[model samples]
Target chain A: MKKKHIYIYSPSSAVRDKAAYRRGIQRLQALGHEVEVDEAALSTYQRFAGDDRTRVAALSRAAASRADVALISRGGYGLTRILDAIPCKAIAKAIERGTEFVGLSDFTALQCALFAKTGAVSWSGPALGEDFGAEDGPDEIMEACFDDLLQGQGEGTGWRVPPREAEMLAGFRGLHGATLWGGNLCVLTSLLGTPYFPAVDKGVLFLEDVNEHPYRIERMLDQLRHAGVLARQKAVLLGHFTGTRKLPHDRGFDMRTVADRLRGLIKAPVLTGLPFGHVPTKVLLPVGAKVEVAADGRDVFMVWGHRHAPGHRAH
Target chain B: MKKKHIYIYSPSSAVRDKAAYRRGIQRLQALGHEVEVDEAALSTYQRFAGDDRTRVAALSRAAASRADVALISRGGYGLTRILDAIPCKAIAKAIERGTEFVGLSDFTALQCALFAKTGAVSWSGPALGEDFGAEDGPDEIMEACFDDLLQGQGEGTGWRVPPREAEMLAGFRGLHGATLWGGNLCVLTSLLGTPYFPAVDKGVLFLEDVNEHPYRIERMLDQLRHAGVLARQKAVLLGHFTGTRKLPHDRGFDMRTVADRLRGLIKAPVLTGLPFGHVPTKVLLPVGAKVEVAADGRDVFMVWGHRHAPGHRAH
Candidate 1:
């Protein structure tokens, strides 16, 4: 594979760990990839990576730089503040030039905004500091999956969930051309009723979150469900929800119970255990990509791009 | 004043404190009001006041009961689940018969749905168990305010906030007939993009919440602002936000800082210290009511209903 240029920048909240950011850049270079760090990546303005102007300028610069991939340095709580000011057309132009804009969590806002404003697809996967710069190094699965995606070899990803989820997915077998979308639940929910929200019809929406309890998750899903967003989807994928603390008030209602309630409410199939979100071993997914999904017993496979061959089957 | 017929029911989460429910009923009765408890009020199904069918039935019955006041027993996580099954027309008819549906927190969903579906005004105030049946008895301010509202005497409520907030409110002076809407921030945000969200134009939106930190609060506010809801409001009154624990990651950002950031982003005046929401000494606010507001130094007064007399101006 040709050596790809990766432009690393921070578009959200400030990255507090300077050492991790340095290590991340080093690792990317060591992996035989050309890395360019944004001038504002280390700039701090309050809790943000920089002031709104600085972050916006950095993003605009990255988009115009024409890198093969523009990866976020970290994800926090800043992109939302600068959504209106972001150079969407520039970013879309970058995507037109084959830049796979990638990051998760707060990046969901930017990705969704890009899709809404330009109908361009971006990768919903790892960040530089959080994933590549982990103290123990990136998880093998994540690194391999990312490498394949960057090399244009990873056309699809597969994972096995609990057997019960197979029953859920069975209801939606042979569903074809479903637009695959969604990322961090809270960020996605934040875009609701806003111009930045994408009006994707019959899309397979996958969601994940961190540090939010079942009730909060349920509330966000309820918002989407009530908004008629859920009924228009071919399927709803559930990824990992971590860093939550159980409260005494929950009474027996947990994430599973929440999922059950959602299954009862939404017309679309609700399948769990997708390898995505705030987890180490995750797949690189293309947001806004048309894909086909199938289930075989306890296994679920999602195929997109060139991987959706005529003879391909879920087995 | 005539004895008011007050219907007490649990239409959302179940009330684990049965004793408190009973005490609340006794308090209403002691205040010379006829209290009708819905049969399903005490029924428990998981964390809900009852199953969806039962809760929906109770709400429909309350709306059709034609009581002077329909007060919820408590607020929790259930109303969003049964939003579809709710009888909006029936509730509107009940409001037509002079029933003032009231509650906060999760009740925001039901209240906003009512306003959206039928444009009926409800109360964003106390609940039966949590407010009237408080362990220390109903708060004097809350009790007095409730009395005044039930007797049609509390046409307006006023409170003093920090003098600095007066500058924020100054931008909206002479603003009349701003539809006063909104409740718990999270619940209101949940209604965003949903059919049940009221498209209030140039309204005075008041928001309050519990157990949410500054970042979360700021995120929700950003959503509303980005959605153009905040820009459409004549003023944004912030009520009590309590019960949140400070996280180490917050650095120096706090509720005050969050308010400052919102003031910068929104076009409307952002005033703080409204006497409402998840607090003991709250003022009963008429949700969806058309009202006028004015700021005098450190004092803010909101006047609605027939109390807008020539001589009844803010001091």
Candidate 2:
């Protein structure tokens, strides 16, 4: 793969683990990529990467970096606070120039807002510290996917549904031309009534989250359903919902129940096990891109094609 | 005070503490009120009082009970799932007949939906197990507030703002004829883009929550702000945002900061220390009712007046 220039910035929580962040930058260099770090990328104030203005300025720098890709340091909580001030036009222009914006979690705020404001696509993938700098070394699959994104050779990704749910998702086969839109469920749900929420009709919405209880997940999905979001979707994809603490009082209630209940509520086909979330073996997904979905028994695949070619302008 | 009929129903989480639930009924009975418990009030299906249809039936029975006030067994998580099937007309008719619906947390969904669908008022106050059945005994303030509701004498409620914030809130005085709405921050936020969210312009929005970190609180408030809800409000009254687990990374980003940052974001007066939320000394406030706000030094009073007389139809 050809070497790529990666721009790193912090638009969310502060970098509490500087060593891990440093390791991530080193790992990117080891992979033969030129990395540029934003001046305020390591800045801190309270629980944020910096105050709102600093983070917004950091985002502005990322958009104007002219690098091949702009990646987030980590995802915690900040982007939503700076949504109003995000340079959406510059971001969309950067995407137009083939600079793919990549991050997840809090970055969902930026992805959705950019799409809502300018209809530009962004990547929902790894963060620097959390993904590339994992203590056990970066997972091979994730690194390969990131490389594929850089090389523009990735057409799509696929995963096998859990055995029990395989048959339940058989009907989710063969969907084409549906706009793909969604990211961290909590962040996406927070944009519900705000102008930042994307207005994509019949989109293939995929969602994942970390450290959220099943009940809260169900509540957020119910909110989307109540807001008529789910009804307008062609299909609903569930990625990994990780790091939840279940209480004894929850009894048999969990993510499975939440998904089952959601399936019963909405008419769209709901499929699970997308292998994209806060897990090590995750795949890169394109937010606000048109895609085709297919399933062979339990193996589900979403093909966004090689839409990253310069001036392609899939949107 | 004249004896009033109190209908107890389980529209949300199941009664996990049977003893506490029983004590609540006993306390209400001992207080000289005719207490009627819905047949499915104690029924359980996983974490809910019953399954969706069962809970919906329980809500129907509560609305039909014609009791002076209908109270919830407890709040955990349930109501959002059944929002579509909730009997809005029946609830409105019940309120028209002087049956005031009451509860908090999950019940906020129903309150907002009721107001949006039929312009009916519900009470944002105590639940049976947590409030009336406390091991130490029901809080006198909560009991008095409940009594005030039962007797049609709760014209208003007041509390003293924190001393440091007193001067910051002097301008919050004299807000007249604004709708008093909002309950359980998380639940209320989940209804944002949904039809369930009330369209109350120039309202006084009061919010409270439990187990949410200050970041989550700020994110939710920012959502309301971005959605234009806060700007349209006459004022924002923040009750106790309780049960947070602060991390070392917070570094002083707490509720005070959340309030201060919010005050800077919008023009409406943002006042804190309303005696409500998941606390022992919570005061009842009528959701969807018109209210007047006044401040004297550090004290804030929200006056809803007694608008429950027959055929009054304040809406």
Candidate 3:
């Protein structure tokens, strides 16, 4: 395997699995890859201490500049705060120089922003949070993501879901040409009017959320529909929105309800129960990658990463 | 107190509070008024299902033909789905006849639509969810809402949230005149590209949310900002976004952060921690009610509406 230089940047929450972060750094070192940990990025104090912004901005720039890969420490609650403040142009230019970015959850804001502002396709995968030093995450997910992005391997496949009888309805057309965009649904919706989320038309939008009720999910979906987002998309792919606390009076508006709502509004195919998002066995997808959605009648297949040669960068 | 007929209409979920709906019915009945329940107006199984759109249209026509009070049951999630289905012309004619309209939350969509389609100032306050229940709601809230609409019994008070602390920054000037609109932040955002949420260039926009985390709140606020909704508002009044479940990282971006984010984006004064929205002790406001926003540094007062007379309707 090629030696990859990964720079870790997280300038928000300092205490979000400190041990795991150190352990990951050790693991990367043991693997003989060059891993740079910018400790300055871990300066966030009690959420939005004014200090975190400057540090986050600086670390974002530094991580993007010299590293072959930029690894966000964890998905914490501080990216959006520093989004406008961060030097997006500098980060974009770094991507132009070729640097792979990776993170999910709160990191989604940064990933989306990188794509929107810089046209850099960033991956949403394991961060230093629950995935690191944990057996919960499938080893295949980690290997597939690293091989595809770092090793510049061909299209990484294997998109599967546990047994479910909900058949894909009439809308699943196996065509995906648009940029793969989205992260946490709630966070993505939050980016509605900001410069972070550029015009998302004809994009295969993917989203996931955790610990929200079905009604709340319905509300967020309603917001997206009202915003004319769902109608504009070519396909709506839902990640596993787990830990959904259903209200007593909630009438079947589960993940299925969300899918139905999207199906009702959009002409595009709406597919739910994807293995990505906040689920344990999550797959990785780049926010800005041009990909294809191959859906047979039974299950949808995500052909992540375009056909890139070992030495070529799409950007 | 004179006897007056009370009609209850909801977008969806508000009908479940049997106590509130029943009390509202009984309150009017005990006062020797004909208490009427618009079962079609109540938010039910399918929201607008069995809503009897034709009858609703006819009722609006009859009431508008005679200038009657038409109270909406509750607010949840159905109005927009029934927009084209609802008899717009009849509702508009009724508003023209000075028929009073009321409701909030999901009902905000309907109320905003009524205002856009017509010119009636719809009232937003205690709904059939709590108004007609066995347990009495705040008397002041009920009196202020119905009294103002029925008999011009109270001032069309603009609206305001008490300051969070003694030391707080205030921006934007005093004494402004624009449209008063908005409801559940998620719901209003949903109305973005649709005909429901018209261009309120310099309006005093009101917003609220329920059960969403801080990041979710920030994301929704971000969406509003991105959609040009936040930047255009003259001033923003935030209501109670209560009991948001704790996210993995509860950053400082609660309601205060939401207000701050709005403040950062727009030159308008952003007020937070209002006793409205999903909270119990909320004040009623009239959407499309042209009112004044007054701020004397220490005190911010929104005073509008006229008070009801003694002989008008049962009080």
Candidate 4:
């Protein structure tokens, strides 16, 4: 095990708190690791990382070049605006040199594209402006990710997911393991048909989203179902689908209806209400790990391990 | 002009309401046209048109074979599920016989697919469920759409749209006379890189969506922006993007900011807050009609037709 450096990036235009972003840097620094902050990469406007494409692009390239790991400053809106401006080839070349990129929410597009173009392993985890920036989430979760990156430590299992009513099984069959993929549902859906969305066949699919109504959420699930993404997965794991409310005059449609529609449409075993998304408590999910989503009694557990490595499969 | 027969068809799951499905039948009948409710074509399930490949495929083929003008029952989801199951060649053969089709919302998938696969003159417009079954829109709108379909009655000159203090663009140049094509933003984005989205290199793109938070809405816009869909347009016409406080925690995103984003991203002239979507007062916008977006006057006016078509462009 060796020390790893993580780079941070942003793709959304929603205004972020400066103090919060700094706190994330401090938290990571306290864990006895080298930390770097390039102000040039921070968003200047309410939602943009920065309007200056050169600064955004240069910081993106520099972060990749300098780090063993790359993280997003935050997720909102703006990456699609600056992605072409960023040096994709150089970023890809840097990943080949061993830097892993990660973050979630609006940053999903960038992670997907990075994986698509460079095959770099990307995780949908805490961003400085989003997750770690907040006062919530246990310090242990952050430590968990950090330890996993370096030393590959704290790799335990039998993780408990909530609602416990999630389904599984369509293209999914007896005991197959592959890398976990996907991020915020809204962001992942945006990359539909784009070169970014990797093939999900025989892969475990994970999704989460914030502030989408039941019908809109249902429609997105419909989009994935119709596109054959949901049906092709070996198993479906859902995180948070927040902000669903029933309108007074609009009782005909709601989030539960959406959940039901998804259950009906997708033959794959679908699970709901996983503790992730725009919530306080979050789980550190490694995207490119050999993880097992096995059924244990009435509950299902997602376990990860390093093959043939010491302390592997501790769960 | 003689009234034309419009058949209702939705293969795969029926995402629309049965009442609306029935209402569409009644509306066309009330307008003095031959309307038939084929029970076999109707989906028994509330949310789904049908289940299983065999049933959906049979229903789709039979409906396509019998219909003159197929007014899609509604577009909530399902077409793509049974797309490969249906006989594309037969549908193409039916389109060759000059059978027209129209629907918007989730229906965009079917419309785009049929058009791409068979060259059908499919359109994005009022769905049978939300538009017709509910007895809820302005009488004028219903009259306008029906007349346009039945008699080819053109709409009147530059109609005034209601004003909102949205993100206004300075130096908004006037653009007149461009073909209109597009519907829900979510639907259109889904059609990206798909066969259904027409090449509108210099055409006006009309868009609307319901129940999407500002962030999600912005992301869809970003998808269109990054894909260069917006830059290719001659002018951008925004329809109603309804904001609802369904969830207690849901703070609606500003549509004005959306307009501002479009202004910043699109080189083409962009306008906002048109009355068209899940609203009481909706404008019947022909998905493929020539219209004028004039910014030279005190307000933004969308003028379509030869100036006497009973249609007034919303300002």
Number of the predicted model whose lDDT against the real structure is largest: 2
Model 2 agreement with the true structure over A84-136: per-residue lDDT tens digits: 99999999998988889999999999999999999999999999998888888
In terms of lDDT, the poorest run of 10 residues in model 3 chain A is A157-166
Candidate 1 residue-wise lDDT, B1-315, digit = tens = 768889888888888988888899999999899999888988888788888899999998898777778999999888888788888888877776667788889999998998898888888889999899898899999988888867767888888878777665555565688899999999999989989899999899999999887788888999998888898998888999998778766667789888988878777778889988789989988788899887777788898865324333221
**TM-score of chain B as predicted in candidate 1:** 0.95
Tens-place lDDT digits, model 4, residues A13-86: 53357777777777666655566655555646544555646456644665455675676676766665555555
Q: Candidate 4: fnat, from 0 to 1?
A: 0.16
Candidate 4 falls in which docking quality class?
incorrect
Off by over 4 Å in 2: A310-315, B310-315
Tens digits of per-residue lDDT, candidate 2, B228-303, equal 9999998888998888889999999998899999988998888888899999999999999999888899888889
lDDT of 1 by residue, A1-315 (tens): 657789999898888887788888899899999999898988887678888899999999889777878999999898888789989998987777677798999999999999999988889999998899988898899988888866767788887878777666566556789899999999999999999999999899999999998888998998899888998998899999998778776778899999988888878888889999898888999999999887787788898865324333111
What are the TM values for chain B, all candidates? 0.95, 0.97, 0.83, 0.76
DockQ of each: 0.62, 0.87, 0.39, 0.19
lDDT tens digits by residue: candidate 4, B1-315? 576666666654454355666776787788777765445466544445656454456445544645555666656555544544556566555544544455667666555565556544444566666677776642566557645644545453333433432224335555666766677787678665544456666778878888776656777787777666777788777777887334322234366766776677767766666666666456556555567666543366666664223343110
lDDT of 3 at A70: 80
Can you give the lDDT of residue B240 in candidate 2? 88
Docking quality of model 1: it rates as medium
**TM-score quality measure for candidate 1:** 0.94
TM-score of chain A of each: 0.95, 0.97, 0.88, 0.82
